[model samples]
Target: MQKILLLSVSAGAGHVRAAEAIRAYANIGDAHLEVLHLDVMQYVTAGFRKIYTDFYIKLVNKAPALWGYLYNSSNDAQADSSIEKLRQKLERMNARALLKEITAFKPDAIICTHFLPAEILSRQLKKEVLNCPVWVQVTDFDLHRMWVHEGMAGYFAANDEVAFRMQAQGIAAEKISVTGIPIMPSFTAVASREQCAAEFGLDGKRTTILLMGGGAGLGSLDAIAARLLAMEGDFQLIAMAGKNEAALAALQALSLRYPGRVLPQGFTDKVERLMACVDLVVTKPGGLTTSECLAMGLPMIVNAPIPGQEERNADFLLEQGVALKAFDAVTLEYRIRYLLDNPSKLAEMSIKARALGRPAAGQQVLDTVLSQHP
Candidate 1:
């Protein structure tokens, strides 16, 4: 058996979800491969863990402009080598036990869904501590300089644009694979809209829209939901407040005020099912969420994406004709109204989304790795 260690950081759910998706795909009758998925942050100190997980969320939510500046400023490999070296040293120190896990597993190959482990493992590789090949799957439509390490055996890109970016930055074209971002297999599978609608007590044909602001209050689900509810249309809304209890409560109140029209949902594993019946998704274009939308062939009205990889993801979606972006509530309202009033445009967006979706990406990543290792 070929053992593969899949490491992810919990800086956001996307990394962890991407790792799990790969592991899940491997288990679907691929008995020759053994995959272990881990959250590397759990091996570090609580304070360090918070810096990786909580600080990122707080930074983006509280001070997005600073985050954008930092993100853009760090995109070049030559831009901040010294500062990055210092951070990498800190990462290796805080994440030393990650080496212990790798040693214990002694896997044939390693795949990292997040860059932290890849950087740490790259350090170890220099000293011949771990001799196996390490690969990286970038969990976004855009690539950051931090992700462009020297020791990777191969790299997975979400699309051709990112592949080109990697090559532009000196990575060999042979090492890059355009596999899209791995999403849960459920998204790609066939789901019945009528059944999903009945399960959620929704009308299957009412020009429904799915609204998600992500868990971190990134796009203000409450405010956006209020505006959408106030609009005049023959539509029902499914507003998802992912892990945000306050947002959930506010949405519940909206449901009361607009009974039978507004469906309020908290964090759910049933997003694919809810997505089955909805005609459009108004979302903050996080990488994993956007990939899921694409896999479902759902048209998107991207609402105020955070100013970094998300904005980049939105740009790609817009360029591909799969989505339209709205920077504020007024723009979002106008765009949604326009789409609802024009069925042909929405249908076109859905077709484009499907054309761009890579639902089998999880299997593809596994196949690429095993082809080399086995």
Candidate 2:
């Protein structure tokens, strides 16, 4: 059996989800390949993990302009030194245990879904501590400078644009491939509209709008839902408040207010099933969720993406014509009505989205890693 270690961090749910998706797809394609998933936080203390995650959320939510400034500033040539400093910091905190765990696993290959592990493992390779191939899957539409590292066996990008970014950052063109962000297998196999309606208690003939607040339910979803509810249209709305109890409760109350027209769902494992039937998705442009929407051929309404990576992702979506951005409740409602009023325009965006979606990204990533290792 070929053992593969999949390293991810829970800084955001996207990284962990991407790692799991690749592992699942690899098993489906090659039963003999054994993939082990590890959270990079395991190397550090719980306090460290909490502080990192909390600081990230606070920075994005409370001081997005500062985050954007830092994100942009880090893209300069001086960022190399910053990254080295970060690696050294991690080295001082957790590198020894992480290296020990990796060596003990004796895996044929290591794959990282987050940059932290990739950088840490790169240091190991440089130090001649672990002798195995290392691969990284960049889980976002845009490549951050922090993700660039030397000594990777290969790197998987969401598109050719990201691959070019990687090459420009000194990675070899041959080492990078444009495989869309890896997503769950459920996204690859979509149900028809009628089939989805039967399964989810939705109306097949009515326009269906999906409102999602991302994994941790981090957005102004309640406000968005109210605005959409006030809009004049023949539509059914499905709002997914992922892991946010307060949001789910609020949406549930709204469902009562709207009767059968609104449906509220809590954190769910069935996003693909819902995506399969939706006419459009109103969401924050997180990499993994937006990729799933694209795979389902659903056009997106992205409103005020958290600065830095999400803003960059929204920009890419807008450039590709698969999504429309509305930063406020009024504009969001206007965009929804515009799409609902013009089926032809919605259909065109769906076509563009489908053209951009790569449903087989997981399988492609697995194949690339295995081919390089063998």
Candidate 3:
């Protein structure tokens, strides 16, 4: 039996979710696979995690322009020295512990869903401390230079354009494989829309809109839901407030007033089923959620993406013609109304979305990792 280690961070839900999807796909029972999902912050002090998470939330909530600037600056070659120094500081603490763990596991290969782990492992290989191959599964459509590192065996990208960008950045073309972002297998499986609606006790004849805010349930959800309900249209709205007890309670109370028209769910494992029954998705553009929506052939109305990677994701989906973007609650309401009014346009976008779906991306990534070991 062979061993493989999977690593990810929990700054956001997408990274951990992607790691789980890959783990589910690589269920080699006889291979003695051990998936160690780590939130790199956990290895650090509580102060460190608090500072990092708070900084991220502040950037997304208040300083989006600055965040966008910082994101763009990371792409500049001149910033490599400063960024590498910061990486070294982080690596010294958690990276040392991670290396010790990897040494003990003696895994055939290390697969990283987050860039931090990949950076640490790549540094280990560069220093001749670890010799196993390292594979990185980038969870975004845009290839940030931070994700590109020396000593990496290969990169699994989300699209051909990202692969091209990686190649242009000195990574060999053969070292970059365009396997779409890995998503849970459930997203790929087809569920009868009528069946799913019936199970949820939703009206099958009216269009259904799914409102999500990633796993944290942070977005302009309340405002958007109110506007959605106000529209004089024949549509049912379902809001999934993930792990946000307050938001869920608020939505639940609101739903009572609306009766059978609105449904509020609290942290559910049935997003795939809900997605199957919906005609459109209104959410923030996190990589995992976007990939899941694409897998389900559901067109998206991107509400507000965070300034850095998520903004890039929104651009990718828009370029693919599979999604529309709205910057605020009012804009979202208008876009939703437009989409619902034009079924033909909605169907066309859905067709393009289905065409772009890479449902077997997890398996493809697993195969690539195994090939490197073999």
Candidate 4:
């Protein structure tokens, strides 16, 4: 059996999600491969892990501007600020335990979904502390400078634009593969509208819309839901307020207020099923969510992408004609109404979305990584 280690961080669900998606593919597609999915944060100190993972959510939610500033600052190699230096020092110090585990695992190849683990492994590889090939998977549509390290065997990107960005950052063009963001195999399963509607107790004849804000539920979902409810249409709403109890409660209350028009779901494993029944989705452009939606061949109306990478994700989706962006609740409502009323436009977007989707991305990435292994 071949040993493979997948390194990911919990800073956001997307990185870990991407790792799991690939892990799943490896498990089912290649029975001879032995895979271990490790959250890199677990090897770090509790405080450091919490600060990087949980605190990140608070930062993006409360002080998005500061988050955006830090994101942009890290992109500049010339601006080696003290904070960046300190962070790197801490990451290296915390990586000692991770290094020990890697040495013991004796993996043939190591795959990284988050940048922190990539940087640590890159430095170790350059120093010859580890000999296994290291593959870095860029989970977002945009490439941050932190993900570009000195010693990487290969780079897997979500799209050609991201691959081009990595190439411009000094990585060899041949080292990059545009695999599309890997999504779980569950997303590849086909579901008919009638099947999902009957299972979820929804009207089969009505146009269904899914409103979601990724896993953290960070957008103005309540406002968007309110706007949606006020519209007059032959539509049903599936509001997936992921892990947001308050948002779920509000959405659930809509069932009483509007009667059968709204269906509220918390963090669910059946998102692929819900998506099958929906005509369109209102969501933020989180790489994982967008990739999943694209895999399902569902068109998107990106309501409010956070100011950094998500904005870039939204830009790519819009440019690809798979999605439309709305700057505010009013525009979100308008787009939904217009798109739903025009089946031709919705079909067009869905066609583009399917064209861009790489449902087998995880399997392709794994094959590339293994093929490069010495």
Which candidate wins on lDDT? 1
Task: State the lDDT at 38 in candidate 1.
Answer: 85
Provide the overall lDDT of each model, using Cα atoms, as 2-decimal numbers: 0.87, 0.85, 0.81, 0.86
Residue-wise lDDT of candidate 1 within 1-374, one digit each (tens)?
Answer: 88999999998789999998999898884787788998998899898898889999899887887888888987754635898777777787886787888889889999999988888888788888779999999999899987878778999999998999999879999999999999887877767999999999999978899998743433467677778889998799999887889999998988888889989999888989999999999888889989999999999988777789888989889999989988777778889999988999999999999888898899899999999998
> What lDDT score goes with residue 308 in model 4?
87
TM-score of every prediction relative to native: 0.95, 0.95, 0.94, 0.94
Candidate 4, lDDT over the whole model:
0.86
Residues 109-146, model 4: lDDT tens digits: 99999998999988798889888888999999999888
Query: TM-score rank, highest first?
Result: 1, 2, 4, 3
The better candidate by TM-score, 1 or 3, is: 1
lDDT per residue (tens digit) for residues 152-205 in model 2 = 899999999999999888999889989999999878887788898878888888
TM-score of 2: 0.95
In candidate 4, stretches whose alpha carbon ends up further than 4 angstroms from where it belongs are 79-82, 214-223
Pitting candidate 2 against candidate 3, the one with the higher lDDT is 2
